[model samples]
Target: MEKYINAFTDSLLNTLDYTWRAMTFDVPWYTNFFWGLTAISLLVWLLEIAFPWRKDQSIFRKDFWLDTFYMYFNFFIFAIVISGVYEILGVLFNDLGITAKSFAIIDIASWPMWAQLLVFFIIIDFVQWFTHVLLHRYEFLWQFHKVHHSVKEMGFAAHLRYHWMENIFYKPLKTFGVMILGGFEPEQAYVVHFIAISIGHLNHSNIKITWGPLKYIFNNPVMHLYHHVKALPDGHRHGINFGISLSLWDYIFKTNYVPEDSGTIELGFPGDEEFPKTFWSQITYGFVKPKKKQPSN
Candidate 1:
C-alpha cells in the first residue's frame, strides 16, 4: 500500500512540475503566445458580450472548438513549420551561389529597443499587407486564404482559423523583407506578431466599436468585416480592404471600404458558399485543384 501511495505521490508532483514549467517557461514563443492570447481573448470576450455587434451570437457559436484547435495548431505546430521552412530556404540560397553570411541583415539592436520594436512593427505589417494582397489576387492562393474567410459567425477565435500551408506562400516574402530592413532577434519579432495578431482577433470579433478617427489609421471591426464582404464595394470587383493591422496601406492604394451598415452584411465567399468544415479538410483544401472554365463555343 505504501509503495502504491508513493508512486501516486510521485506522479502528482511530476504533474505539478510540468504545469509550473509550462506557466513559467519563456523560451518557446508559444508559452508567452498562448498566455497572452488567453488573457487578451478573455477581456475581448467580456467586452464582446457587453458591446456586441450581434447580440444573438453566443460565446459557444458554431466551430468554436475547431477555432480553438486552429489557434493551438497554428501557434505551436505551424510556427515550427515556418521556422523549418526559413532554414531550408537559407540552405537553398547558399546552393544558388549566395552564402548565408552574405545575405545577413544588419543587427538593428544598436537602436533603442522601442525604436527597433516600432521599425519591426511597421515592416512586418507592410509585409503582411503585401502578402495578403497576393493571396486575394490569385485564385490558387485564395484556396488557402479562403479558409479564414469561411466563417459565417465571426468571433475572437475566427482570427486563428487559417489553412496550414499559408506560411509557404507568405513567409518567404516576409522573411526577405525583414532581412532586408534588419533582422530582429526572435523575441522582437514575437512581440510585433503578438500585437498584430491580437488586433486581428479583435477585428474578427463580434465587438463593434468605431474607435472614432483611429479607424482611418488602424483596422477596426467595421473595416475588416467589409473586407470579408462577399461582393466588392462600389468600384473594384475583386475583394478590397486587405490591410492587416494598418489601414493606411489600403487607403493609399484605394482598397479601403467602410459600409454604412457593416452590421447588416453577410460575411464569407460569394453566394455564401461553404468551405471544409473539418480541420484536416481545410488544411488539405489548397491541394485540390480548382476546375478550369470551359471555352465559349
Candidate 2:
C-alpha cells in the first residue's frame, strides 16, 4: 500500500515536471509535443482562414475560446491529474510480473523503423476507431461523449474537446496496442503521434478536404463533418464515420455515411440545445441519471 502511494506521488510530480519542460522547450525539438501541437494548430487555423468551407462562420466562431481551453486542459492538465492512477496500475502490474512483452502478438523489434511506425500507426488508429464506435453505441458512454458533439461550429481545437473520460477509454486501448506488439515501440513513435495530431486537427477544421482519391484511406473534414450531424441514418442509431485517422475502418465496416459534402448541414445531437456550455458543467455533465420523460395521454 505504501509503495503504491509513493509511486503515485512520484509519478504525478514527474508528469508535471515533464509537462513544464515540454512547455519551456527544454526537451528535444522532435519530442516536444507541447509546441508541436501548437504549431500544427496554428498551421491548420491558417488554412481554415484562407479556405474556410463555411464562408459566413467567423474567424473566432462559437465556443472558439472554450474549445481552445479544452485542447490544453485535456492534453496536459488531464494527464497530470490522472498520472497517479496510471502509475499505481503500473506498480501493481510490475508486482504481478506482467511485462510489456507479456502479451506479445508478434515481434516487430527487428523490423525497420519505417515498418515499425507504419504498423504502430495502423494498429493504434484501429483501436481508436473501435473506441469511438463504443462512445456512440452505448448511451452511458454517449452522455460523456455528448460534450464533443456539443460543438455547433467545428474547428481545429474541437478535435480535442471531448470529455476527459474519453481519455480513460482511449489511452488504455492504445497502450494495449503497443503492448501487443511485444513492446516494439520504435524511438520514432513520436512521428506517428504527430501525424495523428495533424490529421485529427485537419479532420475537424473548417477547411474542406477529401484528399482526392486518398479520401478512401484517410479521414477528412468533409466526412467528419457528417459525423457531427444531428440526424442519424435509418439504421445507424449509434453513429457513423467513427474513424479517428483512417476512413478504411468505416469503409470496411460499412459505417461510412457521406451523403453530401455541403458544409451548411446542422451539427450537434438531439438534446444538445440543453447541453452545458461552461467547462465545469460539461466536465460534470453526464454523471447524474437524467430524468425520464413522462408519457403524454
Candidate 3:
C-alpha cells in the first residue's frame, strides 16, 4: 500500500512538472499581446461612451490618435529597450553573486499550474506596492514619475505614457531583485511578467468594475484612477491606490483612498493644463523643467 501511494505521488509530480513546462512556453506572445491590447482599448472606449468624463467630445478627437501612437510606441519600442538593459543588469548581478541563494519556502512549481500563477501574482503585487509607495514619497524619484501623472485623462493608453527612465529604474530592478530573492526559475519569472503587464493595462483601463470586496484582492480600474489625481491644495487628491495587482499592501500601508462622494476627479499635473498638447512637448517638458511644486496648505 505504501509503494502504491508513492507511485501515485510520483506520477502527480511528473504531471505537474510537465504541465508547467508546457504552459510556460505555450504563451503565444503575439496572440496574447494583440488580444490584450484590443480588449483593453475596447473597454476604454466603451467607458468613454458610457460615462463621458468630459462633456466636450472633442477630448477624444484626432489628437487622441497622436496620444495613442505615443502609447503604443513606448509599450513596444521603449519597453524592449529597457528590458534588454534589465537582462544585462541581471547577468552582471549573477556574475557578482549578488543574487539570493535558492531557498524558496514554497515549491509552488510542483503544484498545479493555476496555483503557480496565483502565487506569482500575489508575490509580485506585494513587491510592486511597496516599491510604488517608496517612489511617490521620495522627492528625488518623484521628479521622473510625475510625468505619468501629467496625463489629463485616464484611459487605457495612459498606462504606457511613462518615462522610460522610471521603467528602467523601477520595474526591471524590482522584478529582477524579487526573482533573485525568490529563486524563481526563468519560466516562472516569464509567467509573472506576462501576468503583470496584462493586469497593468487592465488596472489603468476605463472599464468600470464595482469590485466591492474584491477591491481588497485585486487592484481594479476605479482604484487605480484615483492614483492619477493631480495633487491639490486643501488636501492631496483623494487618489492613492498604487498597487498594480492587489490592494492589500496599499491598505496595510495606509495609502489606499476611495472617496464616496468623488467622481472622476480632475486628472493631470497642476501646471500641465497649459502645456502644449503635442507629444514632443509632453516628453521634453517632463524632463527639461523641474516639476512644479505641490501647493502648500
User: In model 3, which runs have C-alpha deviations exceeding 4 angstroms?
Assistant: 1-35, 43-63, 99-107, 185-198, 231-239, 274-277, 284-287, 290-297
Where does model 1 exceed 4 Å of error?
Answer: 1-31, 95-107, 185-187, 271-274, 289-297
lDDT of each: 0.74, 0.93, 0.62
lDDT for each residue of candidate 2 in 5-71, tens digit (9 for 90 to 100):
9999999999999999999989998999899999999999999999999999999999999999999
User: Scored by Cα lDDT, where does model 2 land?
Assistant: 0.93
Query: Top model by lDDT, which number?
Result: 2
Candidate 1, lDDT over the whole model: 0.74
Candidate 2 weakest ten by summed lDDT: 285-294
Pairwise TM-score winner, candidates 1 and 2: 2
lDDT of 2 at 252: 97
Where model 2 places Cα greater than 4 Å from the true spot, the runs are 289-297
lDDT, candidate 3, equals 0.62
Best by TM-score: 2
Candidate 3 matches the true fold with a TM-score of 0.71
